[model samples]
Target: MLSPRESATRERVSLDGLWRFALDPEGRGRSERWWTDELPGDVEVPVPASFNAVLPGRESHDHIGDVWYQRVVRVPRGWDGERIVLRLDAATHRAVVWVSDTQVAEHEGGYTPFEADISEQVRAGEPVRVTVVVNTELHWDSIPPGFVQELEDGRLLQQYFQDFFNYAGLNRSVWLYVTPRTHVDDVTVATTGIDGDTGTIDYRVAVAGDGGHPVRVVVRDAGGAEVARADGAEGTVRIEGVQPWRPGAGYLYTLEVAVLGADGEVVDVYPQPFGVRTVAVDGTRFLINGEPFYFTGFGKHEDFPVHGRGFDPAAMVHDFHLLRWIGANSFRTSHYPYDEAFLDYADRHGVVVMDETAAVGLNLDTGAGVLNQAGPMETYSDSTIDARTQETHRQAIRELIARDKNHPCVVLWSIANEPDTVSPAARPYFEPLVAETRRLDPTRPVAFANFLKATPDLDVISDLFDVLLLNRYYGWYVQTGDLVAAERLLEGELREWAERGKPIVMTEYGADTQPGLHSMLREPWSEEFQIDLLAMYHRVFDRIDAVVGEHIWNFADFATRAGISRVDGNKKGIFTRDRRPKSSAQALRQRWHGTEEPQPDTTRNVQQDPQQDLQGDVPQGVQQPARQA
Candidate 1:
């Protein structure tokens, strides 16, 4: 076993360690003390994941846009000319980093990692303060317009109406790193084409501060046997004649890129683990390692109950175990990007990930009109703002791709989910965005979640992307009352796409059911209904060609403001947001992964008994919806 010190040395600092302060740009955080000092007092705001769940008074503070966070940390000693950097693993919307009151970097987009090298600004030996201000305010140019607080009838109303908790604040880890000046800035290794008999490996290494040194790349199999090695200036290499990475038979390799000085001593190095696996979507078919593979996973949001996005490493490991134990091989990073820790774990574990952009479907402009209030065939235009909106959309995509493109686990790049068709601005934003992603990473496919009734605008640009994904809540969103109707709708759509020779991924499925809740008649919200719905979806998928995968709408019940009965929102998760496994979660695991079946007692629905259930019921905090629509 490795000693803690050795483990710590090898383990990258949790991106969550940096200083955090909550204040407005005008100076709300400058005060030495805050108003409330409760255990999780006014100053002790809950991180977004469990924030609202804990702070009832602050529930009204949840909005779409920015809030401010400032934290101070003592500089670690024994450092010389090392980079004193600040990294936010995942921050919603926009982030600005500062060290000792000096601004170093500004990044947009909430999902990917953003860094600022504060080496020159910080004092070498003295303790220095690093502060980060994350603006969750609305900018049409930014994704997910920031927070808005509405007032109604002598009460304050803040609506963060989304599928998941707007777990803002520094949800992912924050960290500081000390690195050699001349180092391998980045290393990208891709398993481009994999066949039973032949395979290809391509890599790109970004080297900086090497003092005119040449970089060397070494490819090693799992046993540390050198498979291929080469030299390059900017750090690029290709390896052929390799065994392809395949699931159920974990085949992986390591690429070690070393930067050498003129005298040949190693100046800096970067090591990345990768698999030479060929993945493609052929006319609605997903081929991995030359085998037709089906996507059996859930749409996962990167938030937890206790820590929000500040995930404990054990929590991540626990999550992987749960996913495997339950029989899932894929997951969609629904709505935003996730921490690198999650991605790295996925890579080693062989889970297929449909890595998503920070963009979402709510960008649709309802013209202040409720969706149901609109007439049939109403002017279905993208409600998003014009050209400026497109630019922000582009930036979000670029940042996400640039940061995470190399991960073998990430097979698909989802551009946006359900950009509103009611606004004319939607298609213009999507088309060029898809084209640009293709230009950057042609090895992977680009797709968007078709949330609306209409065909997505970018579908015609099929040549640019490898797969077509549709987020259908047919059983929940469109035909909740009729399982047959849901099956028909799903089957019909898959058949149409198959005929077009377009590979399709049922990106979203599953119904919202309060755990343990059973219909006296085993109706829609019952455990039986949930199980039947999933099986029916599988049935529909079985009949279609090119239907490679099916992801249920949600992996767990997240934050929903509706405060409906036991489920605050729809309560569709297989596991509660708190990580409690639900009956449906077990049913899916049993059916798909051949996992053990849960006892009848374990499948008791939560909706009927909120206290006994895994605390999935609506708390008294959020105001109940006035007359469910």
Candidate 2:
């Protein structure tokens, strides 16, 4: 899963930009042999974008089933003998690739990279047709599972339990990269020990193809000066006066791994940037580099108006700047792993991340209006989510760790976001997944965001994780428009969780607010209500000793499935959908940076009625569903 880069013995070319696009609502693209010839439609779509938003009409925006993308690429003249790989950064849901008429590769996951060895299909210095068919369908066995229902009008409707809209297609980049036949396949680096001013780094290099090549490793500091060197496939290098990577102050060492030929010339080289930091959970504290760290950020989604879930570089940079502006330190890639570029930026800026798998929507009972309702059907049974779903979940965890384990910004591995941990069946289902995550990379702690239903008393699987991540909605979903009652309930729950003696992180807690809406009273959907709700949650967090982090439910308003619950989309963002700061954002900035707080309005005397029922005023049970990838 190493990102493609150019080296002395490597080359990379982007297979992005315009590609021939066609929609096959009846799933007839493959059977029609669309790869052998030009598509029937004359439409063109951009790669590294969700086809959903780029196409015209509402039919295209809400397309279901299969879509085809075809393009012609010229193989580099120098890549005659090298191993050429056609890597797709991501192909939503499922994808099948073909070189002209011959099928080459197939992949299932939508959030991780997959590649096909196209050296055999295309000759060097020649143009070859590359066709890809992407399917936007999910089943009970798929990660972030969904279903398709046929309407009376003979149109298929894609439905999912997850709160976010299912934006599908090539949402990331595609690349054609070359490496030596005997090249570096993977590299893993770990900070073994840190004693005073000295630090120890252990590294292992995996090489592919048949070659007994001598492996060389060199570590260079920020000034490009050699700090440490080691020979062979695996070894430890020590550095005196080591600079530890810390929050808001990042330091990186570049580990250049090279394989040498028989004549002592370089055969292949791959440079990996890593930071020397360690993460641990000590009693009721989450520690980074052995120092207790508190997280303050948001649970973000890769969403926008036009791009949908597509990757936008400018937006990414702006987001990191906003994180700094707000004086926040971390964010959870809420329900799925984000693009590698984000993690690279985090490494340079020192923003911690809770890397999560795409195992959202594991609970069968959660939907738009269902919060605390549990059905007779089991989420883990064969008739429902089942064992196949768990396998996909396990693979997602494996790929997530394999791709992100080397990044210092990722301090914790969240296996799932708000799954059915309240059910007895959840224990056996999640036990192996948690163990699998730790087994893959024991360097970091493991956790899953606890659903509101899986409270401190009912949860059966919190002990399996190192940290307890709670996504609570007190003032919003639970005690609507009642800040006093919400505070008491939130505090009572924190007290119950305190008995477990594990570090508790409120991964999500926020209220939806219309930007222009204002009210003297603490009314839901108003700017004042959002600020008041956050202040109440902050108060409870300060009183609890185990509370280590607070990431708001959203960074900005994101699109969700059309329903009565949504007014355009989710408005829980402290900032508007366009990134304009709402009143709550400034309030948070003041609180997190220890500045003067915004004074409450005391001109009007507001009557308090604890017995008031405000349920009818707000959207009934209109809360975010448990997360999925």
Candidate 3:
């Protein structure tokens, strides 16, 4: 979705302070007409934050039903004839919005933006009561599926398979913006090609309303000097001596699109910042700008202490600074799409990203642990996660690509994380989703984070993707406390995957380490063990010719559900929850910043055989591994 912007023809106001909030455990807010009247026993909660962390008592932190947020807003008098819009950057799970007594919009899918044109709901200079109802319930039909159960004492319990806390409420910003009646609705910029000293950018501008008005596009450099111009809704602009955006060094060019009235007056303007970069996947090698690029970073989440999953500018800036200081160059949005403000920072700072959807925990069999006594379950059957769930997954893929397709730092699209791809039924379920991703945006490649249960020999859908993202936890999950056995098993698996001739990225591989817990000998849950486990994986990666990248399990510690497997929260982070560096942080800094030897170039002489095609029927009756979390 196009972000709300301010310009000569547009205006924006942030509704991001304190708002009256109350919990509706019985789900009676709608029946009682909470939109028309004031909320009962309301308390103040900050916008752009998760209410679960800031509220008091376990009853509020573990709330499993609907919540109400109410506030009053006055429309700007100067925005009389313009189209006024109320935009919510995100609302967890589901949301219904109303202005005074008129219901305006309802939306599903929590991680993307949604909006409503409220121009007709209220007068220009009048105050209107704005009410919002947000639901935190998850089901089999929702993305990142979960279930709500009731205990004998009548308290509701929320259960999910993913290893992260389900922080709910309005977790992003809200804005009131105005645009001209016929305004620039969307603009898409694509870097078509890069030749000797020139680069080509193709663009398409979509204008809303019945506007036969002329459209103009201009490209400007960092110094605000016009470099290229085009005079249509869709065309190409070429730049000579183009400065390419590279790793650790970024250069952004602003594309300003404007709609002009018949009287030669500007009606609306939108400036989009984009970088000129190209991403491709060759046999056994990932290429950025036609050169081999190795990914070195972590799979991160939008998490913090008090804010939960909320968007915090201070935390975001500090995380990026820490990434740069550690000599890392990329990260994957582990389970979902992050805030737009984080992507804007990545655009200017040149950090590669693997943009992902909220399709985590698709497998029902591998929920608890990987080595337990459980047989394979049919995860794609009609009774459980059925076609409705697949449709939700499809829509998530669509929205993710639509919102993030223009980002230059987003080099790859991760469709899901740790899905049940070993079952034969999974082949037909995910084949079209992968195809739909390519159909939407063919500029970048698509992948999914492979589960540990679906190994190289057993996975049925590994051949469908351009890149293979494996989330392995050998040292921690499997051969616990045995780095030698872990290294041996990891290398054996890597060799089996090398025959596929696809670029293999170790998307997740780390052990939980408690800060200040040290041992002279190798031991699990200690700082030394975490350091040694990573070093072992790096050794194996350098030996495998197809292994191209390594992103550790997490960048920092994060909250999860209460269980015996976790102490307070997952301690797999190289940095603590408060951004304090652990001992492993220095080890990673030494290895990545050239104090240690660089990884060998293993991309040479690795090509797929032309006769080997993965179009045949998937092998059946392969025994699945035991469960592991």
Point out the higher-scoring one by lDDT: 1 or 3. 3
TM-scores for candidates 1 onward, in order:
0.82, 0.93, 0.93
Q: Write the per-residue lDDT of candidate 2 for residues 468-550, one digit (tens) a residue.
A: 99999998999999889999999999989989999999999999889999998869999999999998888888888788888
* Each prediction's whole-model lDDT (CA): 0.62, 0.85, 0.86
> Candidate 2 regions off by >4 Å?
368-377, 597-629
Residue-level error in angstroms, candidate 3, position 403? 1.4
Among these predicted structures, which one has the highest lDDT?
3
- Indicate whether candidate 1 or candidate 2 has the larger TM-score: 2
Question: Which residue ranges in model 3 land beyond 4 Å of their true spot?
Answer: 368-377, 596-629
Candidate 3 whole-model C-alpha lDDT, 0 to 1: 0.86
Point out the worst 10-residue segment of candidate 3 by lDDT.
618-627
**Candidate 1 lDDT, 202-308, residue by residue in tens:** 77777666357788888888788998888884434455567655553346787877888889887766667788777766655667765677777778776655555
